[model samples]
Target chain A: MSVRKTAFLALFTTFSLAVFAIEHAIPPLVPIPGIKLGLANVVTLILLRHFRARDAIFVLISRILLSSFLFGQALSLLYSLAGGLLSLCVMAAVMGLLQKKALFLTGAMGGLTHNLGQLAMALAITRTIGVLAYLPFLILSGILTGLFTGLCAGFAGKVLAPFLSDIS
Target chain B: MKKNTAWRKPAVIITAFLLLLSTASLLCLLARREKSDYAAEIFQDGVLIKSVYLNDISQTGTFIIQGENGCVNEIEIRPGSIAIISADCPDKLCVRQGFISDSKLPITCLPNRLVIRLRPVSDSSETTAVPDAVTY
Candidate 1:
């Protein structure tokens, strides 16, 4: 089981990294910064449901670090790390409360907090309240994108759950 | 899935409420009519590097912002507008943002932590008259 877990975690990390790189390669849908579907978050949602919290965090941190090194600048690393960790914490807490039933709810809340964390980081870095202007848009986009990722993860989890258990 | 319906009711309501609230605010922000006369302030690394009054510019030229991190963003400053004409950042989204002449939107270079906003020129000098004192 331990060996199998390692393999699964490795595969998840690889997939998340590939997704992150692919997201970067694709042109941003909105010309505005900080707007995206965050497709790799589906992997995080899947890990949260199927694996332990630590495994999810492991995949998240690895994806952020490697993606930043491969395709991002130094400052973006801080931004992504802040957003990723905060979103994961929110997802984990919501999962605990709801017993992991409403995956979309957890994802939505996670998406909101993710933008919030990055917003806070941006505020701290800029030391200006001007950036607060982005709040409403961020919240709106976060929920919609999060809901999308959450639903995808839920469907994927349902389809893959049997296969995972059987193979392991 | 037996009791799933119970919690999902409130969850859906909450999601809907939040979505509505954010959308309302976003629309309001967009619909705002702003004054064209303001200072185009450029800040890099959160420090004020340049502030040009859009309404009262004696010179129209471009300047290159060479950030400490070696990011170069060339800003094109015209009389009534300003824009990031080019940038060395990977995304170049700032350049794509085009020119902005009002306070409604700002041209932001995310990688370099650069922000260019059209804010009301500092209202400090009551004696210098309101509109035409700051232009060089």
Candidate 2:
């Protein structure tokens, strides 16, 4: 890869890591676990749009791995990886299958898939079907939060278009 | 695939559909919350460890719940609500959940593989709700 490409990836990864740390500091909106705004996903969405899925995955994994050391527990890494990889795949597929300017919808899809992935992991680890009770609530939160991040990505992309041209 | 194809049209329709579906299901699940005559059921790795009728408890106390590979959680039992007061798991999400008095949502400690939820007394427990018919 060229120097510019490598630099762009590094910059995006840093941006995502910063967002993850910031989001981590804020207490959960609800006392229940596994619910959050997922603000870092805005960086992933931006990268997915401006760059390739490969670049977005790089940043996503880096952010997850790095943030665990800073604020997350060791076991939480499994949940983050599961949710992150699944959401990335779904978001990329949505972006590919649909036309442009559907950022919000793509984000909502990503959010739904992210929660489903985590739920699956929880079920396997806990070995209880009762955890499935979180499905509807997770889906609702995922959609809402995903939409918010997607819109943030849209505006950020608009603002960065001039600067991103050279890197793209 | 290259054309814009009025993408907003389908996106809006699908968003609306998902919003409605999730909202309806959430309402359905939440309707079971805060019922009278509830029982607290604790489970570890899909196995029922203990259960107590909420109406019977006269005061608050704690139960030490154990999980696979030496995991532990201190669950506080109150008159009608259950809470995880402390835990040794990596993420203390269960402890932060405070208390739950109904079946609306279970307090689950994923790290420890423990779950605490409330059920109405009239409803049968997992042990007694066995299937009677068998064919081989």
Best by DockQ: 2
lDDT of 2 by residue, A38-133 (tens): 888899998898888998999999988888777776467888888999999989977876664778888888887888888888778668776676
Docking class of 1: incorrect
Residues forming the 10-long window of minimal summed lDDT in candidate 1 chain B: B127-136
Model 1 lDDT tens row, A1-168: 488788888898899999877877777665446878888999999898887788899989988888878887658888998899999998987877667787988888888888888889888976867667678778888888888899989999999998666433
DockQ scores for all predicted structures: 0.13, 0.15
Which runs in model 2 stand beyond 4 Å of their true positions? B1-3, B6-13, B34-36, B39-136
Alpha-carbon runs more than 4 Å astray in model 1 = A166-168, B1-6, B9-13, B31-35, B38-136
RMSD of each: 9.2, 9.4
Candidate 2 per-residue lDDT over residues B38-117, each given as its tens digit: 78888888788888888899999987877777888998888988899999988799989898876657889998888777
How many backbone collisions does model 2 have?
0
Task: Name the DockQ score for candidate 1.
Answer: 0.13
lDDT of 1 by residue, B25-57 (tens): 778777754543678888888899888778887
